[model samples]
Target: MHLSNQGLLVILVVGVVAGWLAGRVMAGGGFGLIGDLLVGLVGAFIGDWLMPQLGIHLGVGIVALIINAFIGAVVLLLILRLIGGGFGGRRRWI
Candidate 1:
């Protein structure tokens, strides 16, 4: 399905938020705005595919999309860590 400009924007925003949330939950921090957005978009796609195969359904609407994206992002981060290439390590604070 093709999303309109507005729809795409909404999805992107949701992805950014979901990715940031996931990063914080898994990595103790985010990988910055662009990184989070990228992770979120990929996570959204992953969630869209993985959830069904795992016998999980999040229903429709933006909220569901966020939840799906968040779950997927967390999984993605975990996988990346297991592969020894995730955005790990603590952030430096001055």
Candidate 2:
């Protein structure tokens, strides 16, 4: 569904908060505002895409959004680590 500007803003706020929470939980540390928001937004999309492929279906709503955000944040963190060449001495993805 298409979101109006206000609706999109609200969604973005929620996504950002969700992402921050997820990042804190996964990383055991704080991810500042912008970082959390970006991760959350990306996480939302990643979670939505990856879950279906993994046979995990979450109904749409706050819970699903949060789940998606968390998954996305985790994946983002992993990617960031790999990109920074900090994957514990493992080969980088790129």
Candidate 3:
């Protein structure tokens, strides 16, 4: 199925918001705009899967989607930090 432009825009907004929120929750986790977008997009997938498995359901709609993605992004960021993941030689976000 083809996605409408509005749908794509909505997704982007959700991703950015979710990623930003996750970053706020996890200090030094924000990977900037593009990186946050990617993290958010991937996090959305992880959240969609992990939440259900954990018996954590946030209901439906955009707000729920954002919450789900934020939770997932926080997890992703936590893992990255655990693995010593950083951009270039920068360990702390500036």
Candidate 4:
């Protein structure tokens, strides 16, 4: 479904916040506003693609989207860490 401009804007804002929160919770890092938003938007697509491949389906809704955002943020943080871009400190998760 195509989103109106306002809808898209709302989604972007939500995605940014969700992404930042997810990153904080999962990686203990601050990605700033723009970075969070970009990560969220990209994460949405990646989550949608990966979930099904992993035999998990959340259907579609706000909740599903939020789950997607969280997954995406986690994935992005992992990638960032792998590339030596994560916050410098002890690794929290192994």
Q: What is the C-alpha local distance difference test score of each model?
A: 0.88, 0.75, 0.86, 0.77
Q: Compared with the true structure, what per-residue lDDT tens digits does model 2 show for residues 29-92?
A: 5457787788788878888788888998878877777877778778877787678754334554
Query: What is the TM-score of each predicted model, taking all chains together?
Result: 0.86, 0.74, 0.85, 0.76
lDDT of 3 by residue, 1-94 (tens): 9999999998899899988888777765577898889889889999999999999999989999999998898888888877877434555566
- Candidates 2 and 4 compared by TM-score, better number: 4
Q: Candidate 1 vs candidate 3: which has greater lDDT?
A: 1
**For model 1, what is the C-alpha lDDT against the true structure?**
0.88
Candidate 4 worst ten-residue window by lDDT: 85-94
Give me candidate 4's TM-score against the actual structure: 0.76
lDDT of 4: 0.77
Tell me the tens digit of each residue's lDDT in model 1 across 8-77. Answer: 8998898899999998898457889999999899999889899999999989999999999999988888
The per-residue C-alpha lDDT of model 1 at residue 79 equals: 89
Tell me the spans in candidate 4 whose CA falls farther than 4 Å from its real position.
88-94
Ranking by lDDT: 1, 3, 4, 2
Which 10 residues in a row give candidate 3 its minimum summed lDDT? 85-94
Report the C-alpha displacement of residue 50, candidate 3, in angstroms: 0.3
lDDT of 4 by residue, 25-91 (tens): 8647767788788878887777878888999988777777888777976787788777985676776
Cα-based RMSD of the predictions, in order?
Answer: 3.9, 5.1, 3.4, 3.7
lDDT, residue 8, model 4: 90
